[model samples]
Target: MYDPAYGATDADLITFMGEEVREESAALGRRWFLVAELAGRRFPEMVGRQMYCADSISSVAAEISPVLNISHSRAVWQVETAITLRDRHPQVFKRLCRGLIDYRMVSMIVARTDNVADDVMVELDEAMAGRVEKWMKLSKNKLRDRIDLFIAEFDPAAVRVPPDADKHRYIDIDPGDTAGTAFVSGRLHAEDGAALDQRLDALADTVCSNDPRTKSQRRADACGPLARGEATLACQCGLDDCPARANRAAANAAVIHVLAEQGTIAGTSDKPGYLPGFGVLPAQSVRNLLPAAQTKPVTVPTADTAAQTGYRPNATLTEFLRWRDLTCRWPGCDKPVQRCDIDHTVPWPYGPTHPSNTKHYCRIHHITKTFNTGAGGFTDEQLPDGTIVLTAPTGHTYRSQAHGASMFPALRQPTGTVETTPLPPESPDRIAMMPRRRQTREQDRRERIATERRKRTEIITEQQRQHQAWLAATYEPPPF
Candidate 1:
């Protein structure tokens, strides 16, 4: 162990040892991606799979890899830095990189929807049925849920997904020639005037050319003529039958006229009536804001058809009920359609309405069902396998399962007790691998010297005092 001749100081020994360990750790990190891919499971699933592998040891980093994977595993260089000794200590660096790889893989599949192929969808009849075989096997529903969320966030408009063109983003109403054009004329305030003008410019540009920048980007760059001071407002598209132009214009005029007469600018318009000050309504919004008024049917009041019904005899009870359901049927939401509300798939207006459109929800999900802008506002459709498909406003769709994807199992009985799994223990090896305490060499030397001097001084002072006391006491005793 005495290696002075070799010039090996303790520092040298530690540095050499650290270098070796760091090299080995780096090498392991390099192979992590390949290891994750060969394992059919995603990066998150790898932690469980690796548990059974004899080569697998408990790693703090592996457990958190999914998060790190998305953040750090974007590029090779980033992965190296994330896992290298220069950044993280050798062992710790390796584990962190492992976690990153796992997360990266999971996020990719979820973001892309690697499952639910074109052929698979066609064979399954409806989109939701297709994902059943592919997605059901994953023990954790969180992964699938995350996949759906990712699709919702990143691809909500369903832009450029292959095989199904409808899955991609396209103009809702194609901008064609405006034959049956409608108009909304009124005084627009500063903010409203700016926004409307911007929209008009964007629409005009789109009409001129099919391609334009993104909506948000265009909005940001939009600087159009102000309409705050009274101005004529008219929108014309290339299409002769532009539903938005015709319907919205008609609705707006009716709404404005009514509001003007009443000397009030604000009111919800569900019917084809005019407000005094407000302009025409958008047709898409007409049913929710104002319902048409009609003469009540003559019917003898009966106990069954009580006042609670709010129905008049000879009244279109069917239409009235449809209107109620068409509103935010979710408890407590009164958001008009312009602000955005999910339409129930089943029509309540007609007899034996479709359940899909009847149960509408607004921006805030009611927490009863997964109501969202994704999957096209969460409509239910029967798949070929008789499974119900819940499509978000985004294009991604999933089947309602007997059991949920996470450890929080699906309800057995409505009254069953909910349980939560305990978190696992942390790895000691992982703890050991973190960067060591960073005391300075000078501070350490000073502390050691101070301690040594204090000990030596105490020894010397005790010896001197004892010698002096003994000399004085011995002479006195001899004399006596």
Candidate 2:
């Protein structure tokens, strides 16, 4: 695989591959524009890896990127410029180029190319052409923003607002305001309201003072108490001699002092306005507390999934949630198993149930891994650092590095000067080619749109089936 004649490094491979693709395009009477799409699909692992490990375009080209072709054609000239300028302030260019590439692929994928109605297909092609024009002329940041705006515009089911209903109206209970009858039956004054606002503001200020402690820090803090409590419960004679117990005691004392300073409770009430242990209290009182009311809507999944998977008649939902969370205990990827089908490392039906017996990946990655099995999709192994080591299908093993360590490295500007060679002015031959180029681009854009329409039709059909399944399984149409 590393034969020098074929080009040894990743970059060499990319260049060679790109040349081959260009040749193929020419031989087949295809335009060079489709080469980008082919590159993205054929080398997704390489592309994805570079994106994960790169900081700037210059650094990526030097250390990771696998691109090969460069041109000054209308369709890909801007892209070529962005890539070639990798050595000159690369981060900005990399971001812009990647954004353009990502949206182009995503829009095509999400639009589903085959079945869109004729008029809709025409409109989509027009929109794609406009986006490409912006890409050709705009700065990287502007391009990124435009791509984001475009995605937002086409995202399905984005606005799910329900119709306004009488029951949805807000109810005001302020005693001074003309509203519903008060439950407390107390006289509300301006000062009292002001006082309440002040207290809430203070509480918010204290709670939101700094960023929340990360999961690791919180776990470390919890471990100290847990270890000490376990020791004490075990009645270990070492408890009296243990430094851990002493530290725990000192921490508790400090907590008590902080609680005393901060007001642990409000004034007690017989018929008093508020109860003692309410409102702005000491930090200790609320230290381990989660607010009873949460702002974010909780997605309580239906319990039917496990039942559908052929569980017992009376299975509790708690088990399903636990199983879902446990599917990928590999730190960052906590995808619910209900949404992901299981992948048996040893191949299920033949493999037994064990912790090491299975792993889970989403549909796309699962298929990709299967496709790249010869290259090295992923393998199960635990690293010395307690992180799981999964070999990618590309024959590269990526251990679960510190959550942040796997990210692309910082960008480095190119030290050498980039030669600025302006293109020669267009001749009559080049001018004559302009109309042909425009026509080719328009045709390619139309083809892509057509492809997207088909994909969308397939998706819509799938959605319809899912809807029907839902209706049949859980819903009963009213006496039709």
Candidate 3:
């Protein structure tokens, strides 16, 4: 059914690939147009709405999710891109439709200008559209820098600000596919990560050179003693008086949390135990953790214990909710429960602070609900069994059940019913009372961009001075 490319020369193949890419770009542009149309149809009155704000909610992504077989979050991003290109960057969209610019370039331009004000966006669109097609060979970082340069020149206040890296630092451990092993990973501050790497090397070297383990194996093993705060790793050469062995004071043990059934810990049952961030542990692995484990009994919530008269739940209730929900209760959100806030499904004053009326929401979603609830926003309801029903503004409902319910059936037990009073009429002017930054977004962006540009200028000036000094040191006058 297809012609073979085996006989084609390398040059012919290259030309064919280039043509295919152009055709694909044009097709993707048409697809984006359809996506924009779908979003419009779903929310015809979205003209004045802020589609990309934290408080904004859209069900168009949910509709697209099933059709595209992609995650809701990915679909949401696609919708945003489509709308941005079609409405905010008409000239860029035209270039895209003509296959002069690829989708990747379009995506980058869209993301870079996300915080741009409407008045500035029109100019950015026109400027970028005329130049981006010529940037097909630029590396990703180079392209990003170029886009930022344009933004900095046109509207310094609209340049995208870098996030605080420290706030986003994280560590993750995942169970390996192979039995009885786990993968450890993390992001750390540059100096800290480098120090850790050096420490691991030092610890690994403490073992005798004659030790049979490979360098990498020794380094991996060194992590255990390092985590326990040990100063040195014991030599394994089996010499009676090894020089590397030292009689040192014992360091404090590292603490970790592991959840398991009594039977599993006692070796009477083979049921796998759950490790919060890392997935299921084999029965043997659970038993292995018992040696250094400090067991904490998690009490199951009963009707009486689950209901709270005050706004805050007791520690017991809090623990129960964390174990039950496992992650943020917002549909498709996977933020761990440890990092989430226990929010009342129905506002506290109108409803009792009971398990049945509360669920986990990460900080972002918590604020999203706080500012975007009422006649034109999302609604949240909870069933007695810790199941949440979230209804979007477009009237599409998404259901999320407690993730831990499958592991612990007791979590599904109903808490006592609480009567909820009708909420007070929402003020039409409430939008005006929403929180505002001390400095406006534009002001903040401007300051950040100015600081960045100043630093770059300083660096360039220093480099030029260094170059002039080097040339002066090497100078020799020509003899007449």
Off by over 4 Å in 3: 1-88, 95-103, 109-195, 205-213, 231-250, 267-271, 406-408, 427-435, 454-480
Q: What lDDT tens digits, residue by residue, belong to model 1 across residues 376-415?
A: 1344543221123554433445543211101112111121
Query: Which ranges in model 2 have alpha carbons more than 4 Å from their true place?
Result: 1-338, 375-378, 382-387, 401-480
Candidate 2 lDDT over 1-480, as tens digits, reads 447766488788787776664454333222223333333344443432322221122122221111232211222333323322232212322333433333343333233322233444344444644455346456655654564454435543221222335434443423322221122233346576567445433322221113254433433334323333321111123434543334222123111111111122222311111111121232333332223212222122332222222222123333322232333323233333444444544333344222233344444334333333332233444322223455543344444432211211110111121112333433433212211122333356567555554565566679899999988899767895
Best by lDDT: 3
**Candidate 3 accuracy as TM-score:** 0.67
Q: How accurate is candidate 1 locally (lDDT)?
A: 0.33
In model 1, state the lDDT of residue 169: 29
Candidate 1 least-lDDT 10 residues: 404-413
lDDT of 1 at 336: 33
Please write out the lDDT profile of model 3 over residues 1-480, one tens digit for every residue.
Answer: 123456777777787888888989999899889889877775654433342334222456644553464545677788878988988999999888888889779889988886666788888889988899888789999999999999878866566656667878988877677655678988899999999999999888887667778889889888878998987776677887776776433498776666677888888998887777666778898897786678888777677667678899888888888888888877777678888899998898798888899889876567666666776577888988888887776577787888876676777788777789999888876554554446543356567656755555666578789999999999999999
* lDDT of candidates 1 onward, in order: 0.33, 0.34, 0.76
Task: Count the clashes in each prediction.
Answer: 62, 22, 0
Which candidate order results from sorting by TM-score in descending order? Answer: 3, 2, 1
